[model samples]
Target chain A: MTGLKKTILGISDMKNLFQSLNNNYSIDLSNYALSSLKSRVEDFMFNYHFSSIDELIHKVESDASFFQLLLNKVLVETTEMFRDPEFWNFLKINILTRNNYQNELKIWIPECNSGEELYTLQIIIHQLNLQHKIKVCLTTLSPLNIERITKANLEIKKMEINCANFERYQEEGNLEEYFTNKANSFKLNPEIIENAEIISHNLFSDKIPGIFDLIIFRNKMLYYNPSLKIDALKILNTGLKPGGYIAIGIKESLDFPGWDQEFTVISESERIFKKIIRKEE
Target chain B: MSYKYIIIGGSAGSFQTVTNILASLPQDFSMPIFLCLHRLKHVRAGFVEALSIKSNLKVIEPNDKEYIRQHKVYLAPANYHMYFELGNYIGLSTEQAVNHSRPSIDISFASAAYTYKSKLIGIILSGANKDGAYGLSQIKENGGLTIVQDPEECQVKTMTSAAISATNVDHVLKANDIIQLLLKLQNKHF
Candidate 1:
C-alpha cells in the first residue's frame, strides 16, 4: 500500500476508535475540539502500550477500570493552586467578604478536578480566619479525582509558582504555612481542607445539591461546545442564588446572547459576574 | 493559497517581533490572526495592552466562547491554551502544559491545522525553545502554509530553527519580510 493510503487508513481507524468510546461510554465527545482530543487519546494509547485504537478499545471493553482511567485522562487537565491569584483577591474583597456577613457562605466549586482551586479557596478563607463562616463543596466527575484530591499529591516544583502567586496577593506570612511537606509532594494542612467536602459530580448532567453564594465554574466552560456551553451556563445559572457571584477563568467570559439577562458583569477584567435574574426553582 | 486564519507562535524574544508584525498590518486586513506566546501564569494581565499600544489592528485577548471576527488579533491569554471552535468561535483549555508551557504553541497550531486545514497559515517567530516546532510541522502535514523566521535574523534562533527542521517550511523570512508577505497576501486575495 502507498504511504498516503496507509495514513488515510490510520486516521479512519483512530476516528472510529473515538466514535466507539463515545457510543459505548454514553459520553458525548463529539463536541470536543478534535486536535486536543486526538492528541490526548494518542497519549493515552501510548501510555497503555496500545499501538492501535482497536487494541485500546478491546482493553476498555474488557476492563471497566481502564475505561474510568481513560475518562480521567481525556476529561481532566492538570490544574494549579491559586491559578490567577488576583482573581482570588477579587473574590475576597468584592464577593466573599462583602455578602453573607451573618450566615456561613456557601461556595460550590464544580469541576474541581484534583482540588487545587478548592484548596486555594480554603487556604485563603483560613488566612482571612473565615473558616467558620464558609462551607465549601468540591466536585469532580470521578472518585479517582476525589481520592487524588484527598491524597493531595501536589508536586514540590509547583510550590514556586504557587508561592509567587501568593506573594502577588501580598498576603501576610509564608505560603508554606498552608501545606505539610512530604518527600515529593506537599499535602495541604488538614485544617485547611477540614471545612471542604469533595465528591463526584458531573457538571453536564448531575443536579447540584444546593444553590451557592459563589459558584466557581472556572476554566471548565472553555472545553464545551456551543450547545453544551449554553447548557452548562444554564446549569450554573440555576446553581447560583439571586445576587450570588460567579468567577470564571480570567480568560473566560459570560458573553453569549441573553447572558447579561441572567448575570451582570461586576468586574470584566476579573471575569466576575453577579446573578441578576435567578433561575426559577 | 488563500487562508481563513493566520496563526503565529513564539516564545522568549518573539513578543517584540509579534508586536512589530501587528503594527505593520493594515487596519482592514481581513484574516483573523491568532497568537500563542509563552508567558507566566501569575502575570495577571498586560499582554493585550502592550500589543494594543503598538499595533494598528485591533488587538485583544479573546474571551473563551467568544466568536471569532476578521481584522482582529486574538491573543492566547496567560495560563490557558486557546484553540479554534467549530462554530467560528474561540475556545480555551486548562489542559496540562505541553513542552512545559501553557498557551502551548503546538496545541494551538495543531488545532488550527485541523480546523482550518489547508486554509491555515502558521508562522513561527524568534524564541529560545522548540515549543512551536511540532505544531508548525502539524500545520505543514495538514496542507497549511508554514513559515519560520530566518534563524539568522532572529534574536534567539532555537525556536525558528527547530521549526525549520521539523517541516518543509513554506517561507523563511525575517519579521520585516513576513510583514511584507502578509500585506501582499492581504491585497492579493483577501
Candidate 2:
C-alpha cells in the first residue's frame, strides 16, 4: 500500500534485453522461464535505481563490472543450508547409504549457487567419515561466485535459519562448530570443501564435465522454459553414469515426454530419478 | 467483464472461507481458479486434499512449468513462489520470501494481473497480513475486477481492510455473497 511505483517490464522490453545480452555478452537468457526472469530483472532494476529497461540494458552493455554484478544478481542465491531437511535426511538414509560403488563415489552438483548445498553435502560426508570415498564436482555459472564461495564467505543474517535447518536435518553435531564469525558475515570451515573440485561451468552451453554417480541439480531448472528444461535434462542424462541417480528440488518434477523411458522414479516425493541403462547403451 | 481467470489470496484466518467459496462453485466452473495463500514452508502434502474435500472441482498444486488447464483449482505449492508465466504455464521460484511468506499472495496476484489483464478477477479474503494489498491494486490498475471480503465479516480484518485501502475494489461482500457472485459469473459464462 506504500506509494512506491513499480517499473513494469513489457514482453517487448524483455525480448530486447535478452537479444542484447546474447549479442553483446554471449549471455543467452531466452530459454529461461519468462515469469521468474521478468521478476529478477525488475528486482535488479529496482535495486540499482534504473527507471527504464533501456537504461539498465545500456549500463549492462557498457560497464564490465556492472555486467558482472548483473550476472551475479540474475543467478539467484536464495538458498540455505539443509534446505528441506527431510530431503537431505532422505538423501543420507535412502540414497547415499544404499549405494555400493566399486570406484570412488563421484557426485556432480551443477550450479552450486552460494555453496549452501555444497557445504551441506560436505558436512554429511565428513560426518560419515566418507570424505576419501566421495569426490564431488561443483559447477557454477559465475566465476565471482566461485571466488566468494571458495573464500567461505556467507552472510551472517542466514546463520539462524541455517542452524535451525541443520537441527531439522537431525544431525548430531553442533552447526556452530563449522563457522567463524566475522564482520557482517561468517566463514564456513574451509576444510569442508577440501576434496571438492570447484569450477565455472554453464549447464546450457558448456560441455558435460564428466560422468557421475549422483547429480544434485535441485531448483536450477525451475526458471527454465519447458524446451530449455528438456535440453538440460538431456544433458544431465548424458552426464550421468549408468544407473546414476539425479535429484531435483523436492517441489520440482520431470514429467516431460520420454523422461519415464530414460529415467525411473527412485523417490517420487523427493524428486529423485535413476537413469535407465538400456541394452544398446 | 468476462474473466478468464479467478485468483483469490488469503492468509491467517481464511482457509475456511476459501473452502466455502470453492464448495459453492459448480463442477463445470468456466475459468481456472488460482489460490495463493500463506502456508508452511516444510509441510508440502495434504493441503490440496484438504481444500478439495468439499469442492466439486479438482484441486492441484501445479508443478513448475506445468500447463494451465481450465476448471482446475491451482494452489501455490509450499516453499516456492508461483507465477502465472507467459504461454499459459505456471512458473515456480525459490526466491527469498516476500512479506515473510513463500507462495506469496502478492507475487501470484500481480503475475495473474499481468497475464490476464482485464480478463482477471482478483479477490482478497480474511487474513492478518497486508501481503495482498498492493497486488489487488495492481489487478485494479490492469482493469481486472477486484473484490475484498467485507472487513466487518472477516475473521481477521487486516488483509481485506488493507486491500480496500489500497484500491477501489468492485465489491466488499460477505463469504456467502462472494460465493453467490461467483456462481452468477459462472452462470453468465456457461
Candidate 3:
C-alpha cells in the first residue's frame, strides 16, 4: 500500500489543474468539495510519483488514457449491492410497489459507479418481474467504469457484507444465487443487465438524457460544492416528471433553498423526495 | 493557545473512555468536538443514543455538508469517510476505506488538522489497530496539540502505542487525566 502523503497542493494549484482539465478535455471539476478533492489529488500525486500538481496537469493534457485513469481515481466508487438494507426495503415496499405506470417506468441512475447499486435495483426488479414494465438507464463519466460494471466481476470477499445486507433487505433468498463464483471473484449473471442501458454521460456538463419516473442519484452530490449541488439538483428536477420520486443517500439532505418549493419529502429518514407539480400562476 | 476543535479517534476498547470524556464535558463547552471511532458499518443507530445518554452536550452523527456547530459532539457516520470541509461544514464520502476502516480515523484527523491547523486538539484513545497513528502524526505536523491515552492504562494499548511511536505526541495521560485536560482547556486554564 502507498503511504498517504501530506496535502501539498494549495488553492491556486487546484484551480490551475481544474482550469487545465476544463480547457483540454472540457471536464469541469471546479465545484467539487475542495477538502476531499485536495486529499484525493495529493494521494494521486503520491501514488503516481508526481511531486507537483503541474506535472499531473502536463500528463493529463498530453495523454487521454491517463486522464481516464485520473477520472477513475478521482471519482468515488465505494459502493456495495443492497447497502443500507432498510432504505432498500423502504424503496421496495413504499415506492416501487406503489407506483402505477401506464407505459414504461423510466429509472435513471446518474453517475453510476461500479454497478453495485444498479445490480441491487435490477435484483429487486427481477424479483418483481418488472423487467418488461421498467427501463433502467445508467450514466457515468468514465467509459472504463461502464466497461467494468458491464463485466460485473466483484470481489469474493465483499460477498459477506453484500449477503448480510441482502438478507436484511429481503428474507427468502440467498444473494449468492445471483452470481457464479470464479477463482478469485464472482461474476454477476449477465441476464441481470440484459435490458439495462449503459451510457457515458456527464451530469454536470451534459444535457438531461430523458424524462424519468424515478432517479436514484444517491451519495454522488455529497462531493459537490453548494453551487454545483443546486445546479445538479435543477438538472435532476428537469429530468424527473412532476410527481416522480428521487432518492438520495440516507445521510444526504435536500435542505438547500428552493428544494422544498420544488419537491416534497417522502421519507425524511431515507431521504426520498417527490417532485411537486404546481399549477401555473 | 486557544483551540477551536477537539478531535478524538478510537476503536475497539475506547468507547467507555470516550463516554467518560463526553460525560465530563458541560453543555456549554466552547469547542466543537469531532469523534471518529471505528464502528460497525451496518449498525448506525444505537451508538449515538448510547453516547448521548452520558453526554450533557448533544451527540450527533452529522449529515453530509451539515454546518458544524459549537458545543455539540459530531460522530463520523458509519460506512462513510467524514471530512472537515472549508467554511466549517462536514463532508461525507463513500470512498475506499483506509486501513480497512470506513469512517477512518486517519481521514478525519488529517482533514481536521488541515482545516483548523494549530487551532485543533487531536487525541487517540484505546484501540486494537494502528489506524489513528498516521492521523495523530498529521495533527502534530500541522502544529496542533496531540495526545495519546497512557498505553499502560488503556484497555487495548496498540492504538495509543502506535500513535506515540509515530510522532512526538505532547501528552500520554490516563482516562481521567485526559478528561481533566479537556476540561482545563475548555475553562481556558491550559
lDDT of 2: 0.88
Please state every model's RMSD to the true fold in angstroms. Answer: 3.3, 1.7, 1.9
lDDT (10s digit) by residue, model 2, range B68-186: 99989999998899999879999999998898888889999989999999989999999988999988988998999998999999889999999998898999999999999888877
Listed models, DockQ each: 0.65, 0.85, 0.86
- Would you list the clashing residue pairs of candidate 3? none
Those runs of model 3 whose alpha carbons end farther than 4 Å from true positions after fitting are A1-7
| Candidates by DockQ, descending order | 3, 2, 1
Whole-model Cα lDDT per candidate? 0.81, 0.88, 0.90
Q: Model 1, residue B131: displacement in angstroms?
A: 0.9
TM-score of 2: 0.96
Per-residue lDDT for B23 in model 1? 86
lDDT of 1 by residue, A1-281 (tens): 23221111144665677677777887667666554566678777766667677778888877878888888888855677777777888888877767756877899988766787888888879878898889999988777787788876578887877787778776577787888888987777888887788888888777877888888878887766667777777888788888888888777667666887778889887889988864578
| DockQ of candidate model 2 | 0.85
* Among all candidates shown, the one with the greatest lDDT: 3
Where model 1 places Cα greater than 4 Å from the true spot, the runs are: A1-19, A33-35, A255-257, A277-281
A20-82 in candidate 3: lDDT tens per residue? 999998888889998888889888888898888888999999999999888888877878899
